[model samples]
Target chain A: MKTTRRTTILLALVLLALPLAAFAASPSDAGTRWLHVRVVDRSDDGESVRVNLPLDLIASILPEIDIEPHIKDGRVTLAPEQGVQLGDLRAVWAQLRQAADGEYVRVEAGDGNVVVRKAGTLLEIDVQDGPEGAEKVRVRAPLAVLDALFSAPEGEIDLAAAITALAEAGIEDLVQVEDGESSVRIWIDDRPEAP
Target chain B: MPRPRVTLAAVLVATLLLTAGGVVVLAAAEVWRAGTFVLSVRDEGPNGARVAVVVPGIVATLAAVAIPFMLPDEAAARIRPAAPAMRALASELAGLPDAVYVAVEAPGERVLIASRGGVLVIEVDDGPDHVRLAIPLHAARRVLRSVAFAAQRTR
Candidate 1:
């Protein structure tokens, strides 16, 4: 009887710790990702702005916003005259998702250079000299976010799904723009606060 | 012997009354502590004035909780569809970690919105005029959830 009692106590302890162990394992799965944006303008009074927002909260609230005539129900319907076909985007994304990680494109014009590539789980874009003073521009996004972006129906882009994916997928430095006197950075990560 | 017994009985009665009084005071204090919310307003406009208001959060809480019974059926039905999402949003926001969500500083004014210490704070400062509003995050979540519950409880 004592042995049986000990076994029962052990079982109870394990059951009590199960949820806590799960919670500690995957934080992003719990909707704990934060999106951070920081901008510094040295040209002025050395002013800076920082914003950190919770993604799950955004995902929960996105459905209520109505951007009439274009966006509804967390999806965007591209204008016909814009000539952007959903099928084409889907096909291209499928190819990219399957392709091996490598430098895919490099364009050099008279004034600038543009490079697009897939690296590990991220799609990276590096553009230089695109804007007059923007000597370097970099953007990175997870493949999962892109996949979710195109998960909508035949004629729409699923923004809410993409955001939800972004919140779940491992996120890191996303965009950076640097110039002589100003800098802007936007990224998403599991951190609770802006850095 | 009868007089001695009477004295003992009187002592027991006094002890019981004191204990009862102590218990009542503690209960009232707990209630007050649970409902206290502080409001401070300072405006240095043309003339300077400072005022402080102490309000019991229970008033707002009670009003929110009473919505289900007080609201008309048509209105309740109209809000029921959206209640779940609002409740979910409120719940998620309450779980979010403390962070500064907005910080903007311009020439004449500054605005800051942040969640800190289990409270959501919004502050705006423009020269001599300043305003700051803070609400406990958990209290807000409770109120909002109650509102959603009310909406969903339509007949």
Candidate 2:
């Protein structure tokens, strides 16, 4: 009887272990790691722009900018988490139009840097990373232009005030723009951590 | 199968058709019932343009009716290509413990590997081959919950 009981226990253990052994032989044992992404855009004027960044960096910035990711059919799609009403955009546009004083403004990013230019006015802003962990922002424009853009009547531009205005206009709190002499520059050390 | 003569005839006919404003529609009627419908115009000067519409609908319909006869032929067989994502999932599953069960759905095929206990269903996108497997946030949350529950049960 003891021998039979021992044999039964051994048989039960073997049955339980057989599935475990089969699972151990699966191919997806090691998890995935790095991801690479590349994007290229060409304009009719023969100007081309290319951007290459890691997927992890994009995921880190999504939450900060209020973007959501949807995973379906082995792909992840990104979209704005909150929809912006037309009224909000109209309000911001009205504010910007008043500040522009009938000038055209254009913003572009390429080669790890952002550039903002205001036509008919000496307004140019360049944003990039600094030597340290701090972000570097350089602005070269007229004091009057900066003051008008920031809605500062005293001819003085405050970064905090400008950012507050933008926030009120429905912009996310991703970065704060600072005002400098003859320009505005904002620095923030909010780089996302690498996985 | 008729080489030189057929090729010369095809070229001459194509040139003649182009000059006469006649369009020659080449259609794989086996795939679509409508097939290639050609609408040609022959300008006769004072007589205006004579419009002639040639539709291969009848031929396509006949071919569709004869699909049963064509099925036995090896040439008519549909070939299903294996999806790369399914292959990757299979490779990954091969190294896991025997308790794991995996169900991988590819473009036109479904592969199931059930072993012991845990079940994992992977749905592959019909998108480009470069796209890797993406686990939905809800699914991941469910897995986390299960793991937490198991850990708590053990405790």
Candidate 3:
């Protein structure tokens, strides 16, 4: 009985110490996640191309960010904002074709806004900040976009050429074309698209 | 004998678990600035036989964190594949041909691209903002021959 009791006490002590031991054993954040983006292709009209993004993968790309979900057919649907819209796609492309350095474009969709930097690929879209009735939750695109863009045939089409093309496609005034290497942005006003 | 084997296996498992835990703690210490350090000294017998032990347990831990910044990177020209799976999927998503690219070890990821044309096989290991691409085996052979020729000329 005494031996059993001693063994029981020892086991209990070990159980209690398990967490501390484990804590002492491992470090935190051994693995890390990073944001990625890529381009798929040029649209049929050389306008905007469809991008493939997985919601979970996209969500993991950004650290310390929250995204909202929507209810559809009694199921949850995550909405990720793709910066492209009809009007910005039209005007930005034309201006981009002739835009000099230090120019930017701004695009507004409903209450949401997206800014494009000159000659850069990333479209910084703002989903928050809207009126009480506006749908301004939060969203992010997938890192797969980066994967595709970087892997594409980078032979003749340099990063600047791609950003210029995106601008000339009427992306928006808020959208800026940025320098590929220098990371300088060109800002523009958000203009209303023609109906 | 059976009990001894079981005990040995348990000890081995315990050692492995401890090693893995130590690795994780070290990695966490890198990103979060949190870690536990232990130092001990022991003296035994009449003359005081001394011993010292440090907790980090691995020499590589210090070097892995330090070397990246200290050395200058030599810019060598090379063409390499980057993000084969993402590239394949993006191509398919953008109306390119559908292909399958396997993740090899990470089966949990649902997205993959593969092709069977036997013309060019590409593999992409994707990371945040960076990717590693591997060329097809046939291409590797051709590249190897060219590298051999270059080495011969240098020699």
Best candidate, TM-score-wise? 1
Quality class of the docking in candidate 3, CAPRI style: incorrect
Better of 2 and 3 by DockQ: 2
**What would you estimate as the lDDT of candidate 3?**
0.32
Q: Which stretches of candidate 2 lie over 4 Å from their true place?
A: A1-89, A100-117, A120-125, A129-195, B1-155
TM-score of every candidate's chain A = 0.72, 0.20, 0.21
The alpha-carbon RMSD values of the candidates against the true structure, listed in the order shown, are: 9.2, 30.2, 24.4
C-alpha TM-scores of all predictions: 0.71, 0.18, 0.18
lDDT of 2 by residue, B1-155 (tens): 44444544555555455434322222332224233334444443465545555544344344434444444423222211112222333333323333212333434333333322222223222322222222222222233333323322311
* Global Cα lDDT for candidate 2: 0.34
Cα lDDT tens digits, model 3, A68-138, are: 23321112222225333424433444455455543264666665565444344333343333553243322
Off-target runs (Cα >4 Å) in candidate 3 are A1-54, A62-195, B1-63, B71-155
Q: Write the per-residue lDDT of candidate 1 for residues A122-157, one digit (tens) a residue.
A: 999998884663688889988988988898887788
In candidate 3 chain B, what residue range of length 10 has the lowest lDDT sum? B75-84
* Chain B TM-score (each prediction, in order): 0.60, 0.17, 0.23
**Shift of residue B43 alpha carbon in model 1, Å:** 2.6
lDDT score of residue A45 within candidate 1: 62
